[model samples]
Target: MAEREREPAGWQLEQSAPEAYERYLVPPMFAPWAERLIDATDFERDDRVLDVGCGTGIVARRITDRPGGVGTVVGLDINEKMLEVAETAAAKSQLEIEWRRGDVTDLPFSDGAFDVVLCQQALQFVTDPSAAFREMRRVLGPGGRVAASVWRPLEYNSGYVELAEALERHVGDDAETMMRSPFPEWTGEDLGTLVRDAGFSESLRTIEIGSMRYPSVEEFVRREAASSPLSEPLGNIEPDVREALIEEVRNALEDYIDDEGIVFPMESHLLTAQR
Candidate 1:
């Protein structure tokens, strides 16, 4: 594979991985931050909310169930594959959320079109987060609020740390680096810098840490290996070797397993700013 193509794969998608993303990764990885990010927003009954770089409408769907009636909640993403799954999910749940195909750097909406914007764990995956932040500011009405989160770092995100360690023990450092790429630029000051560079007011950057629980190690391994962009690196290895590494990782997680499932820690830096 080309070097550029060798980067981690979640932001973009393969043909059939969307369902896996929603089924396997949403609860353990994205939903905690999604719930907290939405709660941190100053949403009103009739405010228009936009979730940029929304994956599977996790945050947008939750907005519909918030206290009062919201005017409009739109989920915008660059990947149609993701949008398709998100749309299917909304239909299945009988929720009304507008899912659109658009880039965050140049949002396909009029100026000052939304009253609030939320992005969760997506900024680091973008090639140009500064431009995306500016577009976020541009799309917001006066007194509009923005709340977003990015994974703090691999060391603080226990599940990924152990996963990366297992991959390094087998696949080498290239894969390890790709696995760890989603968490740079996540410090409170670093997050504040993002909004500052985008020409927005200083943000209140705080850390929101949560624990993720999975039913079992087997389920976690199956979903992660089958669904993530990290799967690409494993494709170059022998089946036996790959399975061995999965088993190794699963065994390592036995320490965190409880009756509820395997519990692991996760941390994200939540940044709330104004337009």
Candidate 2:
């Protein structure tokens, strides 16, 4: 007997994971939060900073290279392939960020090993966020801070909303099935509750990062498509549907575009709590 094939229930597409995440995803989608994270965090030169689920070491490098040099910047991620890309980028940029392969929910760091813990856009994929938060809290020193940033509701982020609209038109209402992509969704209040539940005795505040615009609709699409998990499913879509979807996205951005190109706003919420 032959083995059974897995059935597609959700966003079952094999998505594209490209090196350009550092280039594209960083600018519009990620830059806002990265900057907010930097602002919210207070790191001394000798402080040890741990970046959880550090994708391509973007946040790690940012904290390490702040105004003063950090004592140690370590990035931990479950995906070695992502770490490989991160290491390559670090090496190319001449940054000495330590990239480690590990699970965020069960961090391997010693107790009170870090002065600051940062988790950016990583909580969504976590199977257990409370456990992940506890792990992050466990690694923080006394008076240390734990800061995390995650996507607001899809309705809050115009870029993602536009993408979803485009997908819905092409794949019909079923396109939302693609919404189950790797990107996790956690509200601002949810982030605060998680931090408090993890034993952080602190107040939580939601800070609006900012918005970004792409040069053109195609530019936005390429950036989104190249990095989107939905890209694979979109590619598998009949060419007619794919083209139609692209057109729908283009149409959605008409009100937001200028001579510079298509402009869309992306928003994120930052949650900070003390240990």
Candidate 3:
């Protein structure tokens, strides 16, 4: 039998993961942050919005539900499966959202096409986040807003940090590094730089959202294992190693659990830019 190879290192895995579980998993994990982002935008009823990298239309759906928010909301994503899920969810809510399959860096809209372009938890996956920002700027009308958020270093994100540590302990020394650096590791400064280069003036206050707390370690693990494409790669690991990884992750959570349940801290940067 031919030996299996490790998945290539880059943004491709982030762009496309063939797991329905993972794709649908993000909404619940990020519900708190998602609501905060929507509130930050203070979306108006008539704003013609474009949600870039609009995975499953979390942002898009929210906007559609806004009072007097009957204006158009166009959500674009490269993964059709994600769009499909978003479409179904949107339909259930009796909301109308135009979900299209398209790359973030290569948007299919005309210049000055939208009043606001929003992206949430998606910049990290773009091979060229700077290019994606530029595309976002191009699609926005003058004085429009570009809003985005990205996870900070794995160290600040307990879920990812623990997962990386677990992968290292069980899989190999390279596992932690590979998982930690899954996409481009960005800080607030890095995100600011990318937005500035894309021709958007960064808002002085980098609206920092509070850390997310999961009810319990088991629930946290379940959501992560189900939601992130990270699980897809585990199938490549040896079964023994995979089992060890699960145990290690469980052990790591012991430090964070309390009578109130596991309170893992997840830090991410939310920024608004004026185009």
Candidate 4:
């Protein structure tokens, strides 16, 4: 798994977790949102951009690969392994992305350094998501735009709901809550409130729910289980317990497999605003 639990003791990804995550989790869990988040904004080629909380650089690569002059792009993530993976991808693609290992709460750049800031599905993992938004606003240039997305509450997230249910049954409530607690406890209106609290004016707030199709059921369970915060619980127990948990999740996920593949409804909330 590419996820490493963040240190000083918080729910973050482990260093070894990135490779597994990029291969298994990114395709179905995040790839669609990368396209969707970028589509939410009308970014100019020459506009300087920064992707906060970029995991494995999916959004960064897209920004750099955008036709025309998508301008300088920087990716910041607290996970070093994730940054290493991002840098490796940048080298392989020959895209000039400035990837840095840093926290979303405290950006390392000077104030007003970027014209556009994007965070794709990274807000919920932060200790203080609102503070992270404030940092995005802080480093943003005058009239800059910020686009970020968060999974709507756990209840609305089909994939996570199924996974979490299995986890609670196996790992008990403490670990289950620890991992799922990062999900925003409110709605799109609550998301808007956070944006406004960060001194940004919201232009759009929408919940995008769509079906995600994985190539196979095994890959879906492998990737989804590996990347989930629940992975820690599965990892701590004996191999048999972990396998049992995986099997339970796999059987539950079977409801999603179809003629095309493992298709299931997934949802995320997008927030686009200006600072």
Best candidate according to lDDT: 1
lDDT by residue (tens digit), candidate 2, 1-275:
11121111222233336465666777666656786888887778788899999987788877766777889989999987678888887888788888899998999989999999998988888889999999999999998988888766676667668777776766756556555343356666777788888899995677574677766665565555556554555546665666676678777767887766666655567788889
Residue-level lDDT of model 1, residues 146-219, one tens digit each, is: 99988888889777788778878878897788778876746788778879998887578888878876666555
Using all chains and alpha carbons, the TM-scores for the candidates as numbered come to 0.87, 0.87, 0.82, 0.86
Among all windows of ten consecutive residues in candidate 4, which has the lowest summed lDDT? 2-11
* Lowest-sum lDDT 10-residue window in model 1: 5-14
Prediction 2 TM-score vs. true: 0.87
Error of 3 at 34 (Å): 1.5
Candidate 3 lDDT over residue span 119-235, tens digit each: 988887778988899999999887788778777777677667887777766666655665676335677788788888888875633635465455555445444444455555553
lDDT-superior candidate, 1 or 2:
1
Q: Report the lDDT of model 3 for residue 197.
A: 82
C-alpha lDDT score of every prediction, in listed order: 0.80, 0.74, 0.70, 0.78
Winning model by TM-score? 1
Model 1 TM-score? Answer: 0.87
Off by over 4 Å in 4: 1-15, 178-182, 215-217, 228-232, 236-243, 250-254
List candidate 1 segments past 4 Å from native. 1-15, 172-174, 235-237, 251-254, 259-261
Q: Clashes in model 3: which pairs?
A: 22-227
Q: What ranking of all candidate models by TM-score puts the best one first? A: 1, 2, 4, 3
